[model samples]
Target: MKRQHVIGMFDSGVGGLTVMKEILEQIPELRIIYLGDTARVPYGNRSKEELIDFGEEIITFLISQGAEAVVVACNTSSANALPDLKKSFDIPLIGTIEPGARLAVSKTSGGKIGLIATEATVRSKAYSSAISRVLSKGVLPEDQGLRESWQQGEQSIALVKSQACPLFVPLVEAGLSKTPEARGIARTYLSGFDTAGVDALILGCTHYPFLAPVIRDILGEQTALIDPAQAMVDELKSVLDKLDEVQEMKAKSTVKETWKLRFYVSGDPELFQSVGNTLLPGLIQEVRQVIWGD
Candidate 1:
């Protein structure tokens, strides 16, 4: 329970740094350990079974490093593997989907929402399921499944549509967030959702927010865009608060060593150093490469 023991975070690549940045601002006393599977950069295209296996491997590595809790910062992994991973780990596990869904529901006045995420996230239907679970009440017996998909029906919420832009991650990573090519890609990916008349859009992938300016331009100023990072931070604090209270009763106070942040990658460390440092700001002081699947 030591504050300096480190809170572990994992992403397929750099995306999770967004969540890490927020956590540092909110809980400045805690140390952090971040690992980016940069060698396997995008988990969005992998099979569900593979993602589950990879998630377990990363969690094991983090726990071995004395992680107090873990944030599965990849949307694809959160959608496909979080449940299984949670069962395997005693530490509290948090994901991005629920918070994003909560934000979408809270921000949309029209009840018409759009989600843009990786192919794996869109295929898993996590966002729709979370939203539907919240809106599922008062359903007539006959109208049960007809009003929305079973997942959404469970939550009693309906999304006008969902789209997958698998290429967005690569584009963002390549520093194309404000480039002409990024704009073109955004225009192509967003045209369908825009035409569907959704009042708000959920930037479902953590990496998508890096492209927010272009995405906003493509979707127009009136459409509300929700970034789940803030919501996820809020959720993390709530869970940590409860855990802190329990630890207090058990007399397990946080250690007072100088907090440190560590970074690891499966690929070349130098490749990620600059971008990673930029994303994490003052949190990361060094980057080390580790052999993955070892």
Candidate 2:
């Protein structure tokens, strides 16, 4: 008599609300549980070890609350901790990198994509590897044995340029997404993509979506700005669809249930709730605090 799986998602702070917003809109019937490690709001500069430890603590808490599937909405966690979490947990899980990569690869005609993320995500080269995997497909069979050449690093396929916009998370957290400072930072970081002829730019960090207006203004209408949150949710919908088809007998979250979006933060619940209300009105009227090492 186990109920349907509740989706669990986490990030360093309120930035993950972008992903949560999409899930709420797309699958309002399903139950969602969100955790934001706001006490450590910026995971972009954290070491891989720290990211793994934080990720484990957050995921464990979510699982304890009856989460059946997990979403690492934070790019840093997806980059450093996803593989480890997958091994440790038996439930179905998803991450931000692959879905974003797939979207950029599909939308970019010139195959020139740019990525803006935290220092850690850029340093890890997660987007580069993910995009390369997507680009490996559809290689012309006559072009010097396409698959072989591409695999051996001979083809000049998709080029993904990355820059770590380290200050972005703090700006977003402070509610400065619309400020002149945000625009200046974006202009400085994004000017290169114009000359590089980037057809699409992936906002690799969960926080970057809040600065989309500033980013789009700099990149112009021609350059498609990619929001990984949207891409992640789109893919999650596909995943849930397949699961529902396969597990028709299992009781699932439905419109009839009294399920509501639950929010938790390791930092100030008041601040997180304040920001979340702006992003998804009425859905985040209250938030709970998560203390560590209890």
Candidate 3:
């Protein structure tokens, strides 16, 4: 792919910015086009059919914007619609679940792993399935792999405990990351991980990073926290490196210069800017609206 082609990313709301931040930091020369479906935010509660429809709509919009690849930044959508999204679009598609699971598996000093996400992600069992599938394939065996120290028995990787914290996203979006209520809810949801003796915890929802401090405080420093966004960024870089090599071999290589960041929202641009600017430090430009089916 040419350097001129943009990377497309989308989420139910501003949470995807967390993933985008990592991508921008690690791959600064890659242009990005992000869409936040704020008009129909909180896709966690939406039906599978609705989520799939939304994913296709966003994918189409991004392709129209000249995107060569797409990242499904929302855990819920990734869990629900990623396969269909990939089938619907020819470009490379990335999701958060596998990366997050891999990180959890790699970091755990104990076989016990915990996953904390929205209801949809929890119900989908995406993280557990991904980890188990990877482990079963021997690509990263649980017994003697990245998390070998964490292995306890023949089972190697044990039950993956998951909790659904539906309220956390709304709290974060409301700018109440440090509020008492947020702390209370986090403590309630995460206390289970502590009891389960998980050596690593996956922050399955992108929005959960906003409550990182509170979560860390409750889970303690010894419990490794895995942020899937960073893992996804690493995965994207690997893909880009391969693409670059292939292009070079074809004698069509183009040097990647400074990349542009563009933002699109399905709701009010002002509200998105307000939240996005706070979530991501740099000044964001090219803010616009994305009307579905346009």
Candidate 4:
């Protein structure tokens, strides 16, 4: 918890760069070490046990790189592996599901929230569970009215509809997110949202943000698209603010602005750089490769 602490974040592929982008914009003073398991991209179909093993290995690599805190930028890993990772790692481990769910609930006027994510995430029902918890707790200011109604002996219920777009990650990674083909797939995957009539739609996968324009056009202006990375970054800032060491350092004068952004991939660095630079132009300067014991 220094003035310029290192934060490690990992995802199955370049998708996590979406989350890292928000962090860079909001907390640029801190160094970031991002690892993308591009060799095993699209964790949508992976088993929970495999995900937990992958999470442990990736997190260990991040810790070796001097990371003081870690962020699970992949929804699949967050849904499946976060609990075990927390038990294994002592640092502050943050995930994307709860923050995104809270934001979706807060913005939802009709009490109907929609979620679009990878197959693994949808299978786990993490978003639905998180949304239910948020509604029950009534922690958000927007839920105050519901809380009051509940206190008056009225039942407050929020409905969640989730759809799994298994191909989204592959499409985005292949640099086809802006293409017509991607739109067609998005239309098919998101058709249910039109019927569900959710006021807010959570872009549950980190990769889905790249398809936001296509999704927005399909869903129209009525539905608000929630990017969990934004909420996750806000939560990260709050966590950083509460650290006594960070506060003490801030109180002292003239903390050097030491921040570095580095990217690592378990797969082909060139492919990762190509897709990453396209998704987030000018943000990716260099990408290095990391190998795991097979």
Q: Go through the candidates in order and give each one's C-alpha lDDT.
A: 0.79, 0.81, 0.81, 0.86
Q: Local error of candidate 1 at 234, Å?
A: 1.5
Cα shift from native, residue 137, model 2 (Å): 5.0
TM-score of each: 0.88, 0.88, 0.90, 0.91
Which runs of model 3 end up more than 4 angstroms from their true locations?
1-5, 139-155, 249-259
Q: Which 10 residues in a row give candidate 2 its minimum summed lDDT?
A: 138-147
Candidate 4 lDDT over 1-294, as tens digits, reads 343677899999988989998988888777899999998888999999999999999999999998778999999999988988899988889999899988887777566788899889999998888887976776443656754664576644455688999999999989999999999999999888878777789998999999999999999998989999988998888777766465586685544544488899999999889989999998888899999898
Best by TM-score: 4
lDDT of 1 at 278: 58
Between candidates 1 and 4, the TM-score winner: 4
Which one is best on lDDT? 4
Residues 204-289, model 1: lDDT tens digits: 88888888888888778889898888888887777777777777798876557664678888877776776665544555567888
Better of 1 and 4 by lDDT: 4
Segments in model 4 whose C-alpha atoms lie over 4 Å from true places: 1-3, 141-157, 244-259
Q: How many clashes show up per model?
A: 8, 0, 1, 0
What residue pairs clash in candidate 1, if any at all?
A: 132-155, 132-156, 133-155, 134-155, 135-155, 135-156, 136-155, 136-156
lDDT of 3 by residue, 201-288 (tens): 8888888887899998988899888899988988887777766776679787455656488889998788778767776655576579
Ranking by lDDT: 4, 2, 3, 1
